[model samples]
Target: MRDFLTKKITDIQPSGIRKFFDIVSEQPDAISLGVGEPDFDTPSHMTQEGVRSIQEGRTFYTANAGLIELREKISDYLLFRNKVNYDPKTEIVVTVGGSEAIDIALRTFVDPGDEVIIPQPSFVCYEPITQIVGGTPVTIDLKAENQFMLTPEELEGVLTEKSKILILSYPNNPTGGTMDREALIKIADVVKKHDLLVITDEIYAELVYDEPFTSIAELPGMRERTIVINGFSKGFAMTGWRLGFMAGPEMFMEQLLKLHQYTIMAAPTASQYAALAGLKNNWQETVEPMRLSYEERRNYLHHALEKMGLTCYKAKGAFYLFPQISQFGLSSEEFALRLLDEEKLAVVPGSAFGKSGEGFIRLSYAYSIYELKEAIQRLERFVTRLK
Candidate 1:
């Protein structure tokens, strides 16, 4: 059995976030701030639409690219909101989630031994997926001083003749760092100079707090070279629906669609229609309110963490706060385990994200204000004891 397994699959470590989550599940009184999932239920209108689709017997598989109407809605949404235009007909492929879109994008462009530049303390999937595809994962450690935003110098520092793709996860997971238009433009110039393509994960785009979200694809010369991955999970609280899409130039999308056609066939049909309803009707009524709630929660958690003497970069998007825990003289894993043991509070160790995250921990604020407040109280007590 050991001989039969591919080293590539076997060598990859299991998700560190899930390992802690499973442990927390067994402790009945534990409060978990580890998982990055939205606490809100999928909007009522979207769920109702899914139920109606089934009630009306619309359960058959959609076309390989997905339901044309859904893609068209996605196209319209991107154009109207992000100012980037992608043709629904040829440039978009619906996926099993933004995760699948990421895998496919790497497969589409990267050849064996090609280099994929990944910034650290990002969502955990990118590096392992790059390895499974036989692409070398070149990690850049984003600094706390830079607010964890990847600078143009950082991008240029890792470029090589073998570099094929750069994975950009802004409104970043764990850190919640976002790049403004000017920052993106500078990075775009570097990408163009190096002739490298980009896979920009914008799953958290709609949740931005300080400023409007800007896509790299919206930057000059970027639309043709960047693949945008977004989905219903983060923005619409539809994680269980497992629905997302990737949009890019037709040339790359054609290859991506081929892989998706063979591997995925199409995204779930009911989910597609439900997502259409979300895009078409729920943005103002459902999505906006949820975003506002997250914003409020973020403010509370940021202030609370700072008051407790945890130095955290103020996150601009996403629901996470990555705070430096080095001053306590404990590894992130040690601090996290002790926090869980002493306070029955759970958070992800920063090292779980990457080496760059070693001195920190990621706390999610996607829970209710009541839960966050209670967690903060526990954390305060825990920190005082350590001091």
Candidate 2:
């Protein structure tokens, strides 16, 4: 037999986040701040709705695009919340999760040899997914000095004739950085100049710590060219439900919907109905409380890291703390490994995100304040010994 797998996939690396997670799982009494999942369960109402879905025996596949009612609610949510408008009937397609939404959008838009400008240290999926589709990833290693927000200059520098897409994940992962309206306008100008389509992953849209989250698509002339990705996982504490959606212009969505139909068929039926109930109640009941909890966790972790003499950009969104581990003369991986081995504490190496993340480690604050506090004590012990 010849080689089993294609070189494209074989050459791609597995997620850095998962590597530490696996190791931590084997360590007895280990405290992992690695995975970026919420500690909260699916709110009772949403769970009950899913239960209702099963009780009513409405477990059949939904429309290829999803329930029109759910789509309408999503549309309304986007309009009222993110300041973007899409016709639910034609423009929104609920997906398995934001992960699938990203995969489908990249598949539909990118062609072989096309260049995708991705800002680092971003979510780990974008580069590999671009490669899987035969697209070239052009990385703009974001700087902490700039608060990890992607700059227009940084974006403009990487443009090429083959540049087909720009993935903007604000209220970002790993670093928890966010871009406000002014920052977005500058990016929009560059996108317009380059004529690039954007996949704005606003999965953390509801968790912005400062101003309300703004979608790049909300800007003038950007909606026609941007696909907004969001989901029920983080804010709604429905990660297991596997429900997410995409909002974009009809031209892109019609074809994206066709691809989703052939590939996924439709998102799970019970999950859709459960999500519908979530939206019908406007999501505030669950989301607001989770956001506040995450903020509290963020503050506690931020202060703890500060007290340890580690400096990092204070996260403005999402539930992560990316503190620099370089001062101790250890690589991100080494620091994480030593911490896990010696203190039984687990955090993801920043290098897992991208090369620019080499000297940092990412700690998710989605865990309870109690766990975060315990994790901090272990981390403090580790850091003190290192010093």
Candidate 3:
């Protein structure tokens, strides 16, 4: 028999989220906050536009770089919102989703054995994709004291000649951490010293609260060296749309666009049309309600966790709360599994994000207020038994 499996594919672990999702599916009436996806339906105008695009027979393949109008609109949107400018023609490539964008960016830049710097308690894709591309994933643990933001001091400690890419994900996954301009500037200083390329996942950029969002691309000398990975997934509740894009230096785009062209061909045509409406019309109607709702959930969960005697940080963006559970004297995985099996509540262990997350558990507040209240009640019941 032939040993047929490729090492790269064989070595990778399956998604931590999917592992739990399959479990929750088997249990009747389970309440799941384990997944990071938005519970809201995709906006109406976007759906109508997508159907209209299909009815008009616009289903043929778009350019590998994506529709020029969409790309240009993306450029304008980035410039206007993130204060980061990019040229649509040469500097951007639309991808299947932010996931694909992340993979392409790594595939384009990571030569065999190149090192990628990642912050812990981040979205899981960063490290796995880096490993699949034959890059070393160096994880820097972001602590609760820092609001889970990666520090420049930590960046300096990990630098080596092999380090090629730095992935900055904020408002982060699981932890809901975000970096302000000052924190980013400090990071920029280290990046400048190390001369590294940054692959920033700002998928949660539009979901921020209390403070304005900042993009690393807006840093001086950063736009050219940073590839900004964003998409319609989190912002427009378009996870199923599978539409995302990346903007960076033309040289990098030349490589990423090539990979996108050869592999994905183009992002889904109907989804792109829907995204066009998303980018232009109904922007506020689509995202604002979801953002406001998540903010409320964020505050509710934070306070609720505190009231239950868990130490929780203020989650500035994204819909998750990473609460320290060391007081419970259980590993994060034990806490999560017991909560699911005994309580019919589904939440992910923070350790699933990284070792730094071992003492915490991540609860997604993307669910409704009523559901959140129920979850809090269940959690309090579980905690009462813990004593």
Every model's TM-score: 0.98, 0.98, 0.98
lDDT winner between candidates 1 and 3: 1
Better of 1 and 2 by lDDT: 1
Off by over 4 Å in 1: none
**Tens digits of lDDT, candidate 2, 88-175:** 9999999999999999999999899999999999999999999999999999999999999999999989898999899999998999
Window of ten residues with lowest summed lDDT in model 1: 279-288
List, in order, the clash count of every candidate structure: 0, 0, 0
**lDDT of candidate 1 over 253-341, digit per residue (tens):** 99999999999899999999899999885465778899999999999999999988999999999999999999999999999999999
Global lDDT scores for all candidate models:
0.92, 0.91, 0.89
Model 3 CA deviation exceeding 4 Å by range: none
TM-score between model 3 and native: 0.98
**lDDT of the structure predicted as candidate 1:** 0.92
Q: Candidate 3, clashing residue pairs?
A: none
Worst 10 residues of 2 by lDDT: 278-287
Off by over 4 Å in 2: none
